[model samples]
Target chain A: MEKKIYKPTDIDIERLSALARISLSDTEKESFSCDIATMATYVSSLLSDVSAEHEREARSLDELREDTPVECDCARDILALSPSLKEDHVAVPLVVGKDKEGDA
Target chain B: MNELIFRSLDEHKRALTAREYSSEELTRAYLERIEEKEPSINSFVSLCQDRAIDAAKESDERRRNGAPLSALDGIPYAAKDNIAVAGLPLRCGSRILEGYISPFDATVISRLKSSGCVLLGKTNLDEFAMGTDTETSANGRTKNPLDENRVTGGSSGGSAAAVAAYEAPFTLGSDTGGSVRQPAAFCGIVGLRPTYSALSRYGLVGFSPSLDTIGILSRSASECADIMNATVGADSRDATSRPFPASDLRALIGKDVRGMRIGVVREAIGEGLSEEVLEAMQVATDTLRSLGAKMTEISLPHLHAAYAVYYAFSSAEAASNLSRFDGVRYGYRAESCGSIEELYERSRAEGFGDEVKRRVLFGNFALSGENREKIYGRAVAMRKQIIAELSSVLSRCDLLLLPTASTHAYRAGVKKSALYCKDDLLCTLAALAGLPALSLPYHRDGKLPVGIQLMGPAFSEDRLFSVAHLLESALDRRESAK
Candidate 1:
């Protein structure tokens, strides 16, 4: 099997930051890009031609707990901790709609 | 009253039982000492004054009725902010978790509370337990109690500092890689990172789930054993947790190390080790030899690759674990956002610190579809090899001894990013293998203390404590004889 070489660049870092849902400043991106490039060289050498085996078998189903629900009094406390809240649910910015100006 | 703050758990119990002072009085002394020393140490992120007092009073009452919970009934300790304590702010030393309060206690907290241990407050840490130095904490960096100009090595720095400063007798910290051991070494105290799954992790804010383990920082190895005895047990909430087979975790204390096989990791001794640390290691080895323990030199060929492998795997895990911190729920929210995606981006970008962003970006890069097979997959393979090598070595020897960090605590505000990566190599072997490791401080005259580490095979925490206690006592005698 041929192993593909991976070297992280500025574009790669930008793509990663976006994928990670984090907006980074240009300077920050540049700094991280440099660090990642350094790390890339180190990682490539250490991991070259290595292949991973499947992880050890997980606990069997019989060992797992029954998927059941029980009542508790934590809801009120949990709700109180939310940053923005409605009557019974956490509030967030619009998920599907466009701007207030209706540009979309 | 002030002296009570430094007393061991057993001594405190005897004092309380004999009515030298009430638990409330002892609690008050600690609180006052915290107030006095906090300016210099900056160890605590918050103070649970009211809660501690109430719990201390309750403990006093329990003792008055001759129904004290246990030996730890009146002891006060702090938890790293990353661990949940119901109704207390769980910022995790990051702005992202700012204003967030945990609704329920973590399993360890629950266990400690049940044992009648009073929670002094939450201590500081590197944001989300990412950095080796506590400098990255949003709360403020924790200074080494031994040297004001130096850092208490972190992400467990505050916990170690609190104990070292005598603001609290002991504190809880979490280890992933070397967070617990490094800080304990830096603060001149004992730190224990038990075998993974020996303690529950239900409420610990996960940085790297596979590597993360809640650890103890205290003045003595026996105290660590006491804390472990109280906290070690299986919990349904944490599936990984298992019942420790040993009934008495401290049963090995005071036992001689004669004929015990100690493997000295050869790679850890040369090149990068500071002169003082090398001398300390010599003293430790000489002490063990004098005590009749058999010391042999051993090497881990993969030791050089550990730093890169640890970062790759831990970063991948961190990326996944930290993905839950969007603005919708309990943490900080951006002022304005046109869409949910924007909210997440802005909230995270603003909320996270530089090191976090660096790791997240790198993690995502490594785990990306094209690179995942090359980086993360290979890291997985490398981890297995490391673990196998450690297991093989442990089979040959009862324990592995090495310096906990390459040097004593470095002065605060040094360029930490590169320096920390190198310093942490000594600590990752135990974390990678899920083995029990303990760090015992070796003091030097007019210089910061050096940490000598002992690692044993999985589930060997009891033996590790015994050996550490014997070594600690021997070191103490040597110091006094000087």
Candidate 2:
């Protein structure tokens, strides 16, 4: 199997760096750019000898579970463990909820 | 407390049933043990003190009323952090959900609760069950009880360490690849990855859903079989839950191996195997042969790709499964974001562990439109080929022989092997096939024990257990002779 190196774009960097929440200097970004590319190359071997039909479903098994059995206990527990909890939930400083779609 | 922690779950259950130890006493014993040992061993992430004591007190009440539910009643068992316990932080050994607790119990947890089992605590694991070594946990690394400086074998390393250290009689671990079996081998305990759908995945934070199965680690395979007997079967909550028939997990316990067909995969005994491991495997094969079992040599060239396929498929799926933790709905949220994308980037970057980020970034790259065909698709095809080849091999024989690992216990403090160490290693290949594999510990050799793995066709857990039990007994006899 032939291997191709996929370098992380600036947008990819912006996306992941923000997601990871770590301040990466330009030097770190430069290194990470190389590291991420190498890592992608390493995982790219998964591309070899794998069947296309098998992955028709990207995540493989389509395990869509019902959103029922609203668990109040787990939330209470997490809230309880939170360095700080309020209004019956673990309250972080603030969060901007993303639109449900396109995230996947 | 340490002594109590070391006893098997069956022993604890017997004591509880006989009133030799009150539920409160047993719970207290484990709690104390955790306090003393966990600091050094680093086994648990969360210990639900009030909840565990309350459950123990309730079990005490039931015992007092002469109405205890089952043998497992009042016994304490730890869950791998990846598996949720209602109201406990399912940190998954990662910072992403450091304080995030699910609102419901994992299906296995729920079943265990209904059976009257006490939650000892939650054990440490690889960050999101990604690595084979537990060093990447956000909290801290879980040390192997047997060898403190060495890895405890991960994803399920914490659970295995707990069982090995006697922190808990039995513990729950998720096996995606060799998470359960590898640790079991490292810790010298019995670990069983039951048939693919035998256990429900309702509450297990998915690593690789298709290959992930909730495995049980215990002092003996029998203990694991009992737990499996209790937990296996369909669950309404998990769509993939298979219809497992209710029968004694060890029903074929005494099935003589007089005429059973067993084939040892010649390809499995390649270079990466250690001398000790080779000798141990030879003993197991010899014992089965001596017992009148017809053993044969088989080939599985496709297995060479199990690691490749496993990494590709599992990592790709992981990138998707973890997308839900993006700071918005639940979990850790990093503040001071200008845009939604910033919120996601910062939240994830801050919340997830380095290993998780590595998986996600790598997984994303693999599944991206351009590389999807080149990598993820090809790995899937390889997996399909491997599975089909395994099925064909199964057709030739009833069971396949496996040397749990290609090496013996790598002693603590050793820098990574600077050699060809991939082949015949890790529990991923059998796992990728979603087949039932059992790792049974042979006798201890100067405190380091070895194990042989047995892999059976899909849904052949019953058959696998039967063979395993026989081997265990025979191995026990061999140990006594020594």
Candidate 3:
């Protein structure tokens, strides 16, 4: 028995949007549903028949660049350019705790 | 209009050597023209007036002191905004990176600087270079220089327009599936997507890492070679960059095209190609044949699937590469959010344009766990097939000729979704194979130019530009004779 090819119309835009971490408005959601469906249909129609699988050859040890630390002169400048910095490091929102607003 | 702005790099060098005009005068003339034409064209995203003048002054001093840097010394050129020029805005034509400025120059920018090329300003592009037309830009659309109503095909439209409008002699652009070549074709200029890794991608903002190549747009193939000669080399910063010694790219210029083996892509010339474009290709073929070149018909089996393969791989890479913009370290951040996840979602949703969001979502879909093997995996295998097919054909022929685009420049408001496949059909093969390709314009009198592409094997830029130079010369002679 042969397997059924996935249909482009079956794409769950809400799920993909969640995975991509993009919050789409109602109108955008409607728009993307159609756009993604069209693109997927186009791609699926072309690629469904292809089954060839090939991988690039692994590089020899000598071909790889030696793993060594390189000097970086713009660390201070990079840090300064950050929008939110705490002391010497970039500040991020607490991952597993009350929000900054709650703490305040 | 100042004729100085229209001179080729070589002509400028010669005139400067003869003391015809100082670099300052040339730079100012370009700046003046840019100021006058910018209101209607809207090609530039930002200008570097003071710094450009300062660089010009320094270049003049170097020449006066008999210590000139390189052949490009004092030449004014614009770069696509995505390429970082230290202290300049690095917006990538997206609202997400609105206030961001690059802290350091990209490797190419530093290399061009060392060669004493004056930076005019940064040009507009598609948001994150994700779209075909410049209409997707957060900055205003870049109108075609020849016709304001029509678009300068993007995502390197601004760079092409700058050259077409004589705002600059030449400019730098990035091609990841025909961004550079398509725009150059529309604007009737020369565009080169050099062999992958021929030039370092250290400072270039990544769109699709594997396919993204820093391309050159100039008035002529010889000028493209001049710019490439100064910029092509390996950089430690870009691990994919190779130690290419293919310097003196213009060495074969003016060489006889006699007995040169050229293959015309059979599939590319058939249905879906515009009639005028086909006519232009016919004329180009006759011109090359008249010059004693051997032209034959060739076919690539996988050419039909190139667009699908390109969208899958490029979108996946784009999704991963863009994951760095999480509203944390750099770029725009959301105003208020409950958690980090919400912050990420809101910032990305509010910051990115519609086309970008669609691609990002589609990319995530392709790379998602259940669909990876079915979509992204298949694209990988298909890409290898394309590479194999192209490599095989290139082995037989010295060069492959095809249309750079299906049609000439179209109106600005034409949506991206409608022309999706047709727009990218001709340009994706070179990007997929990581081969060098050049787009040279050929057109009838007072008509929109049609670009004919020349593709060659990897690291074959020297030959590619040489043949392009030959064809360009033939066309120029024919044009002048008219």
Best TM-score among the predictions, by candidate number: 3
Residue A86 lDDT (model 1): 65
**Taking the true A–B contacts (Cα pairs closer than 8 Å), what share appears in each candidate?**
0.55, 0.35, 0.55
The candidate, 1 or 2, that scores higher on TM-score is: 1
Stretches of candidate 1 exceeding 4 Å from the true structure:
A1-11, A49-104, B418-420, B477-482
| Model 1, CA-based lDDT | 0.85
lDDT, model 2, position B39: 80
Compose the digit string of candidate 2's lDDT tens values, residues A31-95: 56666666556555445544445555444543577788665757865654444555776555322
- lDDT of every model, 2 decimals: 0.85, 0.76, 0.85
Better of 2 and 3 by TM-score: 3
Q: What ranges in model 3 sit over 4 Å off?
A: A1-9, A51-104, B418-421, B476-482
Instruction: Write the candidate numbers in order of decreasing TM-score.
Output: 3, 1, 2
Candidates in descending DockQ order: 3, 1, 2
Candidate 1, chain B, TM-score (2 decimals): 0.97
TM-score of each: 0.90, 0.85, 0.90
* Total backbone collisions for each predicted model: 0, 27, 0
**Residue B448 alpha-carbon offset, candidate 3, angstroms:** 0.5
Please write out the lDDT profile of model 3 over residues B320-434, one tens digit for every residue. 8887777875689998799989999999988888878878888998888756766776777778777877888888899898999998898878766422644586899999989
Give lDDT tens digits, candidate 2, residues B1-482. 34666666777878888898888888888888888888899988889989999999999999999998877789888999989887788888777686687767888998898889999889998888887667778888888888787878777889999988877888999998888888888788889888888899888987778788999998887778778877888999888888876477755456677888998988788677777677777878998899888999989876666776777677778887888887887778989999877788778878876567666765676676556666776676677778878889899898988888766556543422111224423477787778889998776446466678999887777777777877875554344435
Tell me the lDDT of model 2 at B185.
83
Report the number of the highest-DockQ candidate: 3
